[model samples]
Target: MKILHASAEYFPYIKMGGLADMLASLTKEQSKTEEVYVALPLIGKLGKSPHWTGKEFPALLPQDDKIDSLVVSVLKASRFLEAEESGLKLYFFQSDLFQTLDSIYGHKEEHFRFAMFSYACYALSQILKVDVFHAHDWHTALSLALQKDSALPIPTVFTIHNLAYQGDHPFWMTGFLKEEPFRLITSPFDHDGKCNYMKAGILSANQITTVSPGYREETLSEPNGFGLSYCLRQRTLDYSGILNGIDTEEWNPKIDKRIFQTYSFLDWKEGKLKNKRELFQEMGRPSLPLDAPLVGLIGRLTYQKGFPTFLQTFTERRHLPHRYVVLGSGDPEMEDAFFQLSETLPEVFYFYKGYNESLAHKIEAASDFFLMPSLFEPCGLNQMYSHTYGSIPIVSRVGGLRDTVEESNLLKFKTGIVFEPNDTSSLGYALERAKDLFQSQEREIVVKNIMNLDWSWKKRKLEYDLVYTKAIELKI
Candidate 1:
């Protein structure tokens, strides 16, 4: 089978979140069994890459009169930039709008940008004659919407990495759409009658999928659905949740070059200690006690991640016997709060205000406990990375965090610490539990069990294969 994955970002080229990582791993694994292709918008960085074959496929797009005042009957011909990575064929659509983009997202014309890109992807899919078209997140959701009523019978799958962002655009953007689809879009695109790309994909695609089973359940209700619960219920029979898997090759502790030392379950204790010491030195901190648990977190420091709640917990429990380290930047208020806390309590807290790929790997390997007190998680990869590195994950009992981490309460299946979301007291109690576990002999057992667990895409890709096959069957 030939499958085409369309998204706004791809790893090693452009990345803003887990969507890139998931696509990179999923396509690489799928390529081993079937032909695979990935389509992305040609951002400034990707266009400048040496491997970029300026090979172009020129196609005309209908223009929105409100947005495209400079253009005439049809917009200027957009070029599809062709390239190849590993065994996958890559197609990057570039237009005047994309020529100046230095980043993958955060543009004022986000809706217009992705609408053109989605059209380019659909045009390329027909040209390539791909059997399955998989669209990721709101960025590529419009592609599925475009293909919903096309004469070409290609099967389409829409994967929702997060439903919170729905690409809500003004209805005037309908000028970009061909008359048939605009007429066919009778489904609910909620929120003050705006055209919602995420809802469009959910209502139009042959199949709808989220990252985890627990997240699927959460999104079917009022709170987690983010106001699309009724629309999701309309397609409940075709919706599914496949838990995401990580790329083991890039994340394996036994051979990772990013960490200070490489080790497996056999010698993890010594390896982690060395990594922890080196990390402390790198951060310019004094040596910590050997038995003290080193807690680490890496990702956007936002309300969704529950960092403010964590700050409250730490403020109230400053004497807790644990050291904390965080590497990420977001929400200016949260960043400043964490920075101030680190300054006020340097002995217990350390904050590195930005993301570093190498430092993230080191943190996963060095820390005795990985902390993710997320109020809601679609499918967190860092926790899985922590499990692979033998770092116990202390997570909230919500979404994928609940699904992936086995609570220490279950002695036989103990892997990490679990607590309630947004509850500072619960987080404090969980941190105390982690400290006790670090001092106990069972720490070794928990680490050993977590390392032995399988969270690789090799097994998880089979589930996707089934979803693709079912999509094709339904299309026929």
Candidate 2:
């Protein structure tokens, strides 16, 4: 099968979130199975090497006249070696009109920027002669709408990374469409009295998918769907979930060059102690005993990540004898709080204010336990990575955290721990349990369990292949 994968961001070139990592990993894995092609926006500043090679394709976009005759260019990606080796083609659209100096979204002409991307994707499909067009997130959702409206020959599949970030512009922005045609194109099922690009894709596509089975169920419910629950419920038969997988080659601690020492499940304890001591010295903390329970957190400092809940638990329970290290940057208030905690409780807390990919690997490898107290996560990769590194994850019982971690593994297999979301007391209880397990010499069992769990992209790629086949079989 010849597949054209369309996303707003791809790894190495442009990446602000997990979607880029997902695309890079999934595409690389899928390349082994089928003829895969990828197309994404050429945003931000990029080196001149991966320059455009294809001829411009004409496209009609909403609102702006300058964007009406947009020129779409195909710039091939060189980051994924497997993609290139398997004869998979990658393309990127470059147009000064679509490229904004500001953020990826939240621009004044946000609708037009993404609309150009959607149309460019369709144009690329025509030029490449793709059998199927796979669209990711709301940014490329409208491509499915365009294909359906034009009655494009190829089938399309849309994957929703996060339903919370639906691109909902004012209805007035869609003035380019005539009244009857607009109503038909932006059907009531597609719009929520406003222009919802994700909704349109969900309504138009042959299949709809989220990152996890737990997240799939959450999107069909009241609180998690963010007002798109009814629409998702109506199309329940067409919706499914495939849990996200990490590129084991990139994330594995056994061969990671970023760490002080490489280690596998067999010698994890000895190497982990070395990493833990190094982490302490680097963070300017006293090198505690090798058996000390070191907890690590690496994610955005936002409400969704349960930063507020973490603060409440740590502050309220002062007698806890665990060391914590955090590496992330977001929400100034949360950053400030972590800094203050690090100062006040210098012995127990260490905070790093920016993102460092190598440092993250070290933290994951060294830490006895990993923390992910997210209020609602959409198939978190960190938890899975932690498992591979033999760092037991103590996560909230929500979203992908729930799907990935099991209490049986925590007890018998000795993999990880779990707590209730949005509850500081529950987080404290789970932490206490982790500390107890650490003191009881059960940490070795936990590491053994975690090392056995596999989250390779090859396994996940097979699941995606099944979805693609089912998508083609279904008539839209």
Candidate 3:
């Protein structure tokens, strides 16, 4: 099948979150058997590469109440890093509007920017005769709506990474679609008389998907859906969930060169010890005891990640026996709070302001336990990464966290610790449990079991292939 995946962010070129990582891995997996292409907006300053090629086309766009157009260029390039090895073709929509943008998102005219990019992606899909149009999140949900507005019998699939971030704008912004034949389509949902990009995708697409089955169930119910439960309920038959996969080749412990030491499950214990000591030394700390639990946290320091609950746990339960290492940058107040806490509790706490790919690998390799106490997780990649790197995840029971990490029960094989979100006591208990597990023999078994489990795109991509075929069968 000729599949065209449309998303706002793609790894290597631009990445704001796991959406980029998942799309990159998914498309690469799909391209192994089928013809796969990716469409992404050329955001920020992208350097010209020797492997890249380009073509220009005029695209009509809605500017306010006026009919305006612009000439956009679609640059075709092989997947970055892999560079044609994966057989995935990436088409970057280049426009004057995107050229000056300093970042991939957070612009005042975000709706207008993505609308133009979406139309350009739709045009590219048509030119390439794509069999299916797959749009990711609200960033490119507009592409699915554009496909519907054209009445172009193209099968479309929309994947919701996070329902919380629907691109909603005032009804007046509908002026972008004011002209005849370009008017907005009526969605199954009405967002307070506003234009909601996510709702349009859910309404128009042939199939809709969330990152995990637990998350899909959450979306079809109240609160978790963030006001779109009714709309999702309307299309329950066509809605489904597929767990996102990690890049096994990039995240594997044995072959990874970024860490201080590398080992497979055979020598994971020794490898982890070496990595741990080196990591501590590098971070300006003495080597902690071998049995001491070194907990690692990586990602955006935001409320959604349960930073508030985590902060409360740290402040109230200072007697807990564990060392904490965090690496991320987000939400200024949370960052400041974490920094201050680390300063006050220097011996047991350490926080890094920004992300470093190599440091992330080292932390994962060295830490005895990885922490992700998320308020909600659509589909978390860190838990999977932690599993692969021999780090047991201590994640909350939400979304993909619950789906991916099985609780450590003595009767059955387990992967990691699971606790309730938003409860300081629950998190404190889970951390204590992790500390206990770290010193027990079961820790070895759990780490080995999780490491052996498959979270790669190899098997999961087949589920997507089924979804695409189903979409084509029920083509709208």
Candidate 4:
């Protein structure tokens, strides 16, 4: 089957979150069975892809002259920068909108920029004769919206990575053309009198998917839905979730050169000690006991990541005895609070202000527990990474966190601890449990259990294959 995966960012080239990593892993694995093609918009700073085909396709729509002229200018100025990585064909669009922006998002004209890019992707997909157009997030939701009522034969599958970032624009952008194209674009995009790209995808897509089943269920309700619950419920038959997958090859602890030691579940204790020794030297340490439990967290330090719970838990009022190593940057208030916590309790906490990929791996290897107190997580990758690295995750019982981490199957593989009533007190309770587990002789069972869990992208790719097949079936 021919599948085209279109997104604004791709891993190792550009990334802001787990979306990039998930797509990168999925396409890489799916290429083994399907003819997978990736379409990414070029941010000028990243420059053209290393290997270039220098190919050009008319990025025009089946519309009139004036709109066609604008499309032609965008397409003429754009080049189809192509490359092959891990048996998948990658096609990147190098255009002024992406180049001038210098970032994947965060532009004042975000809606306009992505709308044009969506059109370009559709044009290229038609040229490529792809069987299915898989649009990731709202950036490519416009493509699905365009294809909804059109005579286009191919089917579209839209994946919602996060519902919070809907591409909402003024409803009057295309008010002049009250015909086919304008009507098509505005009709689905409209939500409470505004152009919401995600609503458009829900209305237009043959199949809609989110990262996890828990998240899928959550988005169908208030709070998590971000006001799109109505649209999602309207498409109940078409919507579902597939848990996000990670590349085990890249994140594996055994062969990774970045970690201080190479070890499996059998030699976990020695491996952790080696990594901890190196981490202590690098991040510095106080006079805490050698066996003090170190919980590690790596991601954006935001409210979504449960930094509020963290700061509250580690504050002067109610402090955690176990140490913490945090790596990330976001929301100045959260950052400052963490900084203060670390300063006040130097022996108990260490905060790294920004992200370090290698350090993330090292932290996963070194720590006894991985902290993901996220209030809401849509298939978190770090928890899985932590599990595979033998760092038992202490997570809040929400979304993917609850689904992935379970207390069942103690003799065999079991997931980590889950805390309810997401708050500082609840987090403190989970940490205390972790501290108890850390000192216990049977701790190896937990570590061994974590190592045995399958966190690979292989199984999830087959589900995607099924979803693609269903999309084609729907179109027929």
Q: In lDDT terms, how accurate is model 2? A: 0.77
Worst lDDT run of 10 residues, candidate 2, spans 74-83
Candidate 3 yields a Cα-based lDDT of: 0.81
Please report, as a residue range, the 10-residue window in candidate 1 with the lowest summed lDDT. 64-73
Error of 3 at 176 (Å): 1.6
Clashing pairs counted in every model: 0, 1, 0, 0
Q: Local error of candidate 3 at 184, Å? A: 2.8
TM-score between model 2 and native: 0.89
Off by over 4 Å in 2: 46-87, 98-106, 177-184, 187-192, 286-290, 409-411
Rank candidates, lDDT, best first: 1, 3, 4, 2
Q: 1 or 2: which has the higher lDDT?
A: 1
Task: Give the TM-score ranking, best first.
Answer: 1, 4, 3, 2
**Candidate 1 lDDT, tens digit per residue, 293-406?**
889989988788898888889878878788889999989999998898789877778899987788999999999999998999998999999999999999999998888987
Which digits, one per residue and each the tens of the lDDT, describe model 2 over residues 1-476? 88999897776566667887788788878887788888776555642235334434433222322332222221121112112322566675656644554335446777767766676676667666777889999888877876776644468888999888888888788654333212235645345578888888888888888899999998898789999998899889888889999888888887899998899989998899889888777777755655678899998888888989998998887787888899998899999999998898787888999877789998998998899999898899899999999888999998888999987643556457889999999999999998888877677877887887989887778787877787788848
Q: In model 1, how large is the Cα lDDT of residue 361?
A: 95
Q: lDDT values of the candidates?
A: 0.83, 0.77, 0.81, 0.80
TM-scores of all models?
0.93, 0.89, 0.92, 0.93
Cα deviation of 34, candidate 1, in Å: 0.9
**In terms of lDDT, which candidate is strongest?**
1
The pairs that clash in candidate 2 are 414-446
Which of candidates 3 and 4 is the stronger one according to TM-score? 4
Q: What is the lDDT of residue 452 in candidate 1?
A: 94
